[model samples]
Target: MTAHETTLCTLFAEVLGLPRVHPGQSFTGLGGDSIQAIQVVSRARLAGLVVTTREVLRSESVSALAAAARTDDRTRDRSGPVTPPRRFGPLAATPIMEWLGELDGPVDTYNQSLVVRTPAGFDAPAAERLVQALLDTHDVLRLRLPEGLAAPVPAARIPEPGTVSAAALVACVDARFATDEELPALMRGHMRAARALLSPREGTMLRAVLLDRGADRQGRLALVVHHLAVDGVSWRILQDDLRTCWAALASGAAPAPDPVHTPFAHWADLLRAEATSGRRMAEAARWDDVLRPAPAPLAGVRAPGPLDPETARNTHVLTLPPEFTGPLLTAAPGLVNGTVNDVLLTGLALAVLNWRRDGDGDGPPGTDPAGGRVLVDVEGHGREDVVDGLDLSRTVGWFTTVYPVRLDLGPTDPADARAAGPALGAALRRVKEDLRAVPDKGIGFGLLRHLNSHTGPGLARRGIPEIGFNYLGRFPMGDDRAWSAAPGHAFALDDADEGLPMAHAVEVNAAAHEGPDGLTLNATWTWAGNAYPGTRVRALAEEWFAMLRALARYTAKPGAAALTPSDVSLADISQADLDSFESQLGELL
Candidate 1:
């Protein structure tokens, strides 16, 4: 490798924590996933270099990446020390802290969307007004952070309504919404094209889109923000604020109250100040304990070959009935004094354990029925409890963390499934308490793990956890009347993709949907390609329903006897039997 290439390779090796990176080794071949890709991009960007993950994946050589990085104008200008933007306190949340904590790098994978729907009497002028209102509301939307600790300069004016690209408009919606097949391909296509228009120097980390389907009759306004700039909560805030702004514009009124809180830069400043004050290091050490690296690598079975490109993927959503959900909500106050999230997490853990055990033919190999341990990676909501009066319902920041919780299932009694609920609940409560005590609430710890390149084949294995749980808050649904007014809006919003896949790798998401009746638990799972087949997933869902029913019965009636696996003859229930059970349950509910 040339001297420059050698220098770059050394930096990569150090930053990535790889023992040694060969000049010709592919990043993906080295097992680089989305998380790692982000790390590489962030680090490279910080070092004044521009290199795409795809290039690194394809080149498979540090020397080539170095050459590309050097020639690329994006990385060459480290002219001066990067200065951070001004800190806005009340508005400043922890999401900005995490982004600033990222070792300067370009973002590789981007999860972007545009929520488009026709508003009543919405037109091009109104759309432009809404865009301007968005710019006026959130400081980050119009501020550009070039370096560290400096005032954020205003971003360029929003493009004209008609001039806005189609793809840009589509990106404002969530991935689940945008994945609909009926939507015009142009919507998706234009989004990708608009994303390409982003200047690496803009450090946008996110973008926006506006769509005017037609004059006054149909129009859609979307903000295609990058994952880096905000988190789920932040998006909700933006959506709510945008609606408020649009309403004002629709009525020929001025935008509502100005945001007075600290900006993200303030959080970044706090992180820096804390890092230097030794608080960050102490916090890091505390995380080291909570996130103690696993002794054994995660177990991952090698794929026989490439995943089937033609494999059909479909998502089915299950909502807990009132009878089942009501008690949990009532008991939530006493159980760990937790929110609905804790209850859902406990249920999910139990579901996973049951699913894993049920999947083993007779029993898991090489272990007694009771000795098998199941590891689950629970996705955290990542908001710091210390943030005074923080309105998670509105603030924006990618404040999510992932923590692995291990459950010893060896002694778990399949015969007494009702008994498992309390144990599962206890484990979740313990994890929650342990996490809350951490200085940074596991955010810094999570970032370090990702940055340090700790999870991989050699450093870590994958199969330790039979399942993953992510509880996203209430899904957003724009005003139906407003949505219908948009012309050419054909996409249907559903919770089909909310479940974990049937494969070995499963992620169960319990999304809350605000309905006339109250909160509905829209649960879905995404399974790994190999680990879960359709039959197995369907069975697990049925089993979960049965378990929930038993728990509800036991909880409601003190003298009721707990049901056993034998009592229900669950093993004998075929796919058809499960389907019938589900149908009956639906009818009864």
Candidate 2:
């Protein structure tokens, strides 16, 4: 490594609290997220290397950043304590946030939960220290969700790490947990979840615990925070930070402190300004016609069930087989000009269409979703680079983008294994095209609806999509289990939002989990049992697999499929059209 690279390596090791960092390691690969990127920029400036946070984020790799960093005579001090943002501003309603305000029903249940059972040797103080570091690192942890637009909520300043919170200890005589049997909502986490779920107010959005099961010496360490404070990407950075902090604490070394980024409050101020601006209003008006119609309902697969208002959602879990999993994920994306999300959703659209045409029309009143096209509530990470100079990739917030997607599959034949492959393949192609046709990946829809400064009657609210789709991408945790140093420390981590509620009628979550064993794709469908039958739900699951199988079969032959338009290629125009245009130009020449 050159002198610059060596300096960066040392800086990252010190800032991130790692023993050492590889010169070639990626910022994200080393568990360094966007917030940490700001710290790096500030620290580098102090060291006389004037670099912007955007530069650090774009560089990603340590070696690249080192070469990119230039010493400026205008640079300030070499080092100083990370300070909290003094300014306060309200963030405009993210699509999900605005929708949450519109709903009169369950808001407390709106949560995101992750549970991990680690070995006994893990200390409570270590865990507490880890959380303190988390709160001190980002001010979003203390962000309060507003009840309505009656008033704006002021942003919270980041408190010192040592002063954040004192770890709470509670005793449970025998903590029996099982994945098969359904337990009472309160019994789930016993400590971390039950309390937070019961009363999930602002300033107390997150909770952590050290659980001990009698004298068994086997314990579980847990951290449960409301969704408003974290997202899929945020969790990745938090997990890595926890592990690093714990290691430093255990080894009797003072943890290297993280630098403060462009504060969430500042980002919120900018978002609010952008949302109400004339430019944003024009942007909203532009999307009025594109998303005017709502998605078709899934009333075709409705089943009879009791209307229990309290118990609404049911979760069904499915794992793809090992043989087909890897190939399906890798092969289909290239063939269909899309992603795992596009492929799976296309199959779902086919399945919905198939069910509508075939299932007994036993839907409740207005529940009939039979149509040639289907609409869905799609969820994106909401990290769109909408504003220049803003880096949200590593910022922790409920940065989810929810918008309607209309998939026009035209028509489908009745369910037949022999014909399923071709039919699914066609639907996948249509889905890729329909998705690509959207402007800026559907970012404008949410901005117009919730954030635009001016709202005209031109963009009135239509009914929302019944089916919600979200792909969690992948789990940050690898297969290497135990957190403790000892051999007997059995450990397991899981992502869950059970007993928690969503605004949508049905939500689908899919994630690719990498482990010591291999890659496995997990699909979780949660629905209001009263609205849909168990039989129909099972069938819907089957349709997703059918689509994957069809995709795999079509791509089985060498050169059977072409790259998806999503893979670094310009969209809207097809290869054949471009080739024909070029040929005509050649003839004219």
Candidate 3:
């Protein structure tokens, strides 16, 4: 192999945890995902090779990527650690501003948590030191919310870590669990106590629960952090940092994890400017159309009520088998010139339309999902490269954006598996095009609706979708021995108050994981129980999975996948015109 190819293979093996990677081995085929791809690109840049996330996915193979990779100094610092600004101040680009305005809802539930195992001999003092280092390293972990949103200086800020106490930042508790079955209930109890322990206004946003088994057995550690300071990507960063800090502390060296690529506070300031930019203001009208109320009431929905944790919230889990998931994540995307999200959502749109059509007509008094349109609020990572010289690959915070999307896949055939092939293809094309039309991956929507002074009021007055969709990107399972996800302990979220209102009637959170079997996509459907029957929701979930299965089978055929007009940025052309152009070009060749 050439020099670049050698470097690419080494990076691939390290990131994917393989003994070695051959030139012809595909990236996705080897279980690499967009999340891992970012790490590869970052490492490659440090080695004087410029390879982007897109290139890693598109070029798949080590040799192919090496040939396409170029030498550049522009991105050398793209993944390096970033230091805090000299002066800590308020951040205006707060995406949670709208949520903060709801005074009655419980703020404690708005948090994410993870449970992992600590190395042998890991105890209280080491864990405490690790927490202090983490708070000092990531500025967002030290964020403070004002007592009231109406306060004069209500914007959140990251105070210098020197003045903060690690013990105060996160409440710590140590307990013992004798067996695996006892772990779940014990973790649940700790999570409930966290509701009282975690307070954004008090700058107490984390709760660390240490689970001890026998001294011979490895112990478990749970870190529950408020959503304001973390997101899905941020967890991976924390895991890496924790491992680094643990090793350093074990060796009697001060643990110094990677620096922040761009501080969350800095990004907040940039978003404040971007929200009121002339370009964003021009998008006000387009957003107005997207947020327009649905023509008909959603199927199986009763009069909506507040998002209650105890009575209203219900969950149904759905999965696509590993056999189908492997292709869906790798080959299926290449077929349609899209990403896994596009294909997965295409299945969802088809299932929703079909389920509504086949319903007992017992839907609330109007046409179910009128005119074959399904309105959904989609969640994004919100870390777009909108601002030059700003990289958020390592930054942590609740940098998430929620925007509405209308999946308009005109009428299709009823639910007949044999004849669903044509409908699947058409739906894929329509949904892919719809997502492509989202401006800046839907980042500006939150800004205009909540942050912009001129457009905020008008956008806020518009209706929100009844359904929400969030696809947490695919990730590899626990491979690191030093600090990996706890085995047989599933509890991860802090318990929310029962009286808080939900944002949507139903919210779908989907993620794919590589397991011993292969890759599997798991989706959890959470809905307000009072508004929708559990039986009906389960039926809908089954329909969604069936649609995904059909999509996977259809794409397995020869010549099933082809580029659509929206896949090209050259000019606006209908699918028919593009198909004709491809046919002619093929004939000439």
Model 3: per-residue Cα lDDT over 1-589, one tens digit each:
9999999999998877678999998676666766677678766765778776767866857889999998956545667676554336675537665544542576654678788877756777777788888888888787777663444443566688765677654444445435656775776687667655777777776778766654566666788888778877777778878887898988999987766657787788888888889888888998988877665545222233465443433888778898788777667766766777788777777767766766534464223546667777888777776876565666778787888788887765635432446667767777888988898888888888888878877877776676778888765564436577775544333244556566777778888876566678988887776556777778778888888878778767755777788777769688767767877877898
Task: Name the better of 1 and 2 by lDDT.
Answer: 2
lDDT of 3: 0.72
When summed lDDT is taken over every stretch of 10 residues in candidate 1, the lowest stretch is 491-500
Off by over 4 Å in 1: 1-109, 112-118, 142-220, 272-317, 321-323, 326-336, 359-373, 385-395, 407-410, 418-440, 447-467, 476-504, 516-518, 528-589
lDDT of 2 by residue, 1-589 (tens): 8878887888777655467988887554454434455556555655657666556645647889888888755335747675544433445445556655554344554455454544445555555666677776766675554443233443333333444353542223234452212222333546444444423343466666555433334445555666666776566556556666666776898554444445656655566666666666666645654444533446211122222222423667788764666666656655654556667677677666656545443444323345457777787766655676454533567667777777776655425422545555556677877787666567667666766535623443444566778877644234334332112221122233333334456667777654545566778776666556767777777776666666656667544454344443575766456445656766798
lDDT, each prediction? 0.45, 0.57, 0.72
Worst 10 residues of 3 by lDDT: 296-305
| Model 2 alpha-carbon drift over 4 Å, by segment | 1-93, 117-120, 145-163, 168-202, 212-219, 294-296, 299-313, 359-372, 410-426, 456-460, 476-478, 482-502, 563-589
Runs of candidate 3 with Cα error greater than 4 angstroms are 2-4, 10-34, 41-87, 100-104, 148-155, 168-177, 213-215, 299-313, 359-369, 414-420, 478-480, 490-495, 580-589
**lDDT, residue 513, model 3:** 70
For each candidate, how many residue pairs have backbone atoms clashing (under 3 Å)?
67, 8, 5
**Model 1, 187: alpha-carbon shift in Å?**
6.8
How well does candidate 1 score on lDDT at residue 318? Answer: 77
Candidate RMSDs in Å, in order, are 20.3, 7.8, 4.1
